[model samples]
Target: MHYVESPTSPLYSSISNTSFSSSPSGTFYFDDDEGEKSDEEEEEPDEEEKNQSLEEVDVSVLKTFLNDKLHQLGEKPQMEYPELDLIPRCRFRPSDYILIVHYVINKVLNYPLPCDWVEDAEELYNHNPELIAGSS
Candidate 1:
């Protein structure tokens, strides 16, 4: 019997230039279900697999690279800035968040920045969810 995949099945990612989607292995298949219904009988792709075609990246490797880079910059950078405690603390790296808040956002707002970098907080948290999740 041919391999068939149904929606709602957990799709373990395949390797080789892995993609969030659009890779050669972007293909997702279901277990062979002879009784499975047709697409006409099924829900749309949005019905939910939660994570389909999740690219297989080694998080440990990514974490190691980040750690080494941070080491190069030294503990001074981390120590000088404040922890972003006003925000409830998601998975974002303290060092990375400080770099952006202390440098990038500070410059963007044209200095005279108050103790709070509140203006850019939402933007940072929203955009970096994936990276934060991966790092965690």
Candidate 2:
């Protein structure tokens, strides 16, 4: 199946707006909005905070905002997703799900997370004092 990406797809931005771009290995953005921001852009506000209030709201609020706008414009929101094979998927172990979920929730809430949560979790899980076996 062909995955058509339109510039105006709000869900593409809304759901994609979640922390999907942040990967343990590298950046992976499904939509253009998540792309690299130059220094000038970094100096600017996050896409959500640009025209909206600086108070970080849940990403679900973005969905609601899009819904209100579309309804007022008399347009129905549609999301045409690429096939599972076509989309890039990240595989995480069961042990990894907790950290991943917490991290995503923090992102949705616009809370700050460590630069690399996976690396941090790994360092803790693999090299913590409990596992050091008698070394002070």
Candidate 3:
């Protein structure tokens, strides 16, 4: 990601936008190239790495267990839920059903959500002890 100083903007005179500010204070402008891919080339993996599956072994086990549980529950698991009928379906994109499947698997495994939702829940109860007791 390259930052080119616009000569027209007078705010930064000596600081060409390319020069990341060494200033140690209040307001400094820095260009953010959030999505720019760098020019560095990535090395291609060998045949062994290329043959590896996207689904991890643990994830595969979880999927199998979930499928078995769903069978026992007498509800056939579907790739897409009935709710997704409202949206234009695509072959590549996962529908609401896929999200639900993931949610259930995580729940059954007692796995916390990626961004620490369990901590947030605990914090919520801590902050509002009365609300927690009352809701239950």
Top lDDT: which candidate number?
Answer: 3
| Error of model 2, residue 12, in angstroms | 9.2
Report every candidate's CA lDDT: 0.40, 0.42, 0.43
Question: Which residue pairs show collisions in model 2?
Answer: none
Query: Candidate 1: where are CA atoms >4 Å away?
Result: 1-54, 77-136
Candidates' RMSD to native: 19.6, 15.5, 22.8
What TM-score would every model get versus the actual structure? 0.22, 0.21, 0.21
Q: Taking the tens digit of each residue's C-alpha lDDT, what string does model 1 give over 55-82?
A: 4333334344334544554544434225
Model 3 TM-score is: 0.21
Q: Using alpha carbons, what is the TM-score of model 2?
A: 0.21
Error at 50, model 1, angstroms: 22
Model 2 segments beyond 4 Å from truth?
Answer: 8-57, 76-136
